[model samples]
Target: MTLRRRATGLALAIATGTTLALTGCDAAKDAASDVIASATAAVASAAQEKMNEIKDGVDAAADVKAGRTSVDGDRTVAEITATNPKDKTADYTVMVNFRDGDGNLLDAVVLNIDGVEPGTSKSGTARSNRTLTGDTTAEIAQALRH
Candidate 1:
């Protein structure tokens, strides 16, 4: 074979191999991205499920109240007060929901205040389970007295 022909053939082969190798790298990158996206979706779904569990609770809105929400570092916090009107001391399971300005649920936290005396109010702090950003407010979602 002629030297010029052999050199051209060798160059063509190298170009083809490089192109295939780059295509394989792109495919690998795409697969990795898909896995990361799926993992992220799973984590988000689990978080929502946990919040829904808190939603399945008793409603005693008349006896409990939530204060304005504040941000302490990356965490959202709020004050909760539970009034015991019963004849005996009772425990309170309070669910505080943090929301955005448009009333979207950002996070929910349960605060347990036990042994509240009759005709008195017990105060406790409720904090977000994860870091929250942007403007947020807090409201009472559910409260159970026992």
Candidate 2:
């Protein structure tokens, strides 16, 4: 072939190769961007789920603290009779007994009273301030009423 024709053909081939290389580089960049976008979306979804779980846990704890259980029970009132006095404080033991309708002993609860005076007949009333899991509190209240 003539030298000028051969040189022209070579230049055309080189230009085509450069164009293909540039297109391949653009495709790679686009693929990488797509992958990054998908990864970012997945991470955001996981974070939202974790936040929802944390909110649910906080709500459950608040319900328990408010004493909003479904347990059936009644309040029992008891009197504090004696106590042991200490420096600016005292402790007293109060007994609470529970029984069924047929007079069968079910349970007993002993609670310590703090800041009570020794040798004093302190006539204070006690009651279950929160809901219980069983009828023990109800039975104790019935026995005290009698």
Candidate 3:
């Protein structure tokens, strides 16, 4: 073959290879984006399911209270003295007593704070005088509202 013809053939091959490689890379990126979108949707669905479960549990506890059944805590005793629900704001005086399931008190602490909105629930970590396991105060608050 002539040198010019050979050179032309080599350039065409390189260009074709580069174009194919770029097309493959674009396909891979599109696939990755699809997978990420699917995973994000799954996570959002799971979170919504969990929130619904919490809301249902709270509603069930409310029914139990209405039936005159005591919905007290097994691991903690929470005394909510003040629940002043103003317009879009709620103030509460929460007294928590860490206890066993058998009504035996383990430790006690008081938390008086504001800024909880009424009709809408909020949750956070409890800073007690004694260290306790899990979220006892938050559970108590949920049960009380129910």
Winner by lDDT: 1
- Compared with the true structure, what per-residue lDDT tens digits does model 3 show for residues 1-146? 33233334434543454455566688755655454334333333432333334332222223111111122343333324333333556443333344445543333333434555655544333332223344333223222222
Specify the highest-TM-score model's number: 1
lDDT of 3 at 112: 39
- Candidate 2 stretches with Cα past 4 Å from truth are 1-73, 83-89, 123-146
**What is the descending TM-score order?**
1, 3, 2
Candidate scoring better on TM-score of 2 and 3: 3
Q: What is the lDDT of candidate 3?
A: 0.36
Please provide TM-scores, in order, for all candidate models, with all chains considered together: 0.61, 0.27, 0.30
* Least accurate 10 contiguous residues by lDDT in model 1: 1-10
By the lDDT metric, which is better: model 1 or model 2? 1
- Error (Å) of candidate 3 at residue 113 is 3.9
The Cα RMSD of model 3 versus the native structure comes to 24.8
RMSD (Å) of each candidate, 1 decimal:
18.7, 32.1, 24.8
Model 3, residue 102: C-alpha shift (Å): 2.4
Show model 1 residue runs off by greater than 4 Å: 1-59
> What does the lDDT read for residue 15 in candidate 1?
47
Q: Which window of ten consecutive residues has the lowest lDDT sum in model 2? A: 58-67
